[model samples]
Target: MRVTLKLATSLDGRIATGSGESKWITGEAARVEGHRLRAGHDAVMVGVETVLADDPELTVRLPRSDEIRQPLRVVLDSRLRTPATARLANPGTMILTAAEPRPVGTAEVERVEAPDGRPAPAPALEALARRGCASVLIEGGGQVAASFLGAGLVDRLEWFRAPILLGGDGRPCVAALALAKLADAPKFRRVSAEPVGDDLWERYDAIR
Candidate 1:
């Protein structure tokens, strides 16, 4: 499956403030573009941390209502940290967990678990494929995005950089890397950037 890491951040490369607070970091243009990008993907993925912090419904909202398409919501919570009341638990909910499957009603879902010792989240992606998802859009809070990059699972990155400077200790916009080695991933580069109000939408291609 094609995996795309999508996120919006301040110019200083902060996803949020020290208190883990972030709202309207990017302008509406980037937001709309993200929604449109979501419509073309099969599902949008994020970590349990994001669900806990933002409680986002993760639905695609196009500028024009007629352009909307509801994508499946996938959460990477190895320990099953998602709250029972989370909106993510309602629709095409997928939890990447390290726990036993639960009995549920009204949710078409699958669990993506990394074994005690193993490689590949492919099995999880395969499960999604069985459910008809051809691609994955990874929305992030930081760690989740880095994990995918570290695991070499991300194929693309769509980022929106806003003009504000949020210099806080919350986390770097990209937190997975230690920065000791610059060529770690060795296969990602910015390919495009466009003005979207005060923010810029940038696209990067990840080499395999």
Candidate 2:
């Protein structure tokens, strides 16, 4: 699957404040562009922590159009901790978990082999690919982003940066990759950069 990682953050690459308040990190235009990006992808994904914290709908909210097919919403819940009352626990949503399959509202539950408790990025993407997802958009908290990048599965990156600054105490856009040296870091080549209202939109492709 073609995996694309999307990040909307402050100038310092912080996704949220120290208290985890992440709403409206970018301008309206950037958010609209985000929805557009979702419309282009076959599936949109996030981690369980994001669901527990934000409870986002993960749906395309743009004006109704024939061309817009709401991408499948996916949550990586290794322990099946996703609440049934969560906004994403509905039809068209899928929960990939390592635990036994159980009902989470009307959403589909698929049990995947997660040996290390968390579902590895390659296997998770393989499962999505088997489900007919040619392209997947990972819109996440932090750990999920790091997992994909660390596994060398991310094909493209769509980043939106606001003008505001969140200090070191703020939540980072990506979690620790555990790279021992600078040369081991995942590299990406800049594809494009443009302004989206008060935010800047940057696009990149994996340098592999």
Best by TM-score: 2
How many clashing pairs per prediction, in order? 0, 0
Off by over 4 Å in 2: 65-67
Question: Which candidate leads in lDDT?
Answer: 2
> Which lDDT tens digits does candidate 1 get at residues 13-62?
88888987788789888888888888889988887789888888788876
For residues 123-178, what per-residue lDDT tens digits would candidate 2 score against the true structure?
A: 88888888899999999979999999998989999999999999999999999999
RMSD of each: 2.5, 1.0
Kindly give the stretch of ten consecutive residues in candidate 1 with the minimal lDDT sum: 111-120
TM-score of every model? Answer: 0.88, 0.97
Q: How accurate is candidate 2 locally (lDDT)?
A: 0.94
Error of 2 at 155 (Å): 0.6
Clashing pairs in 2: none
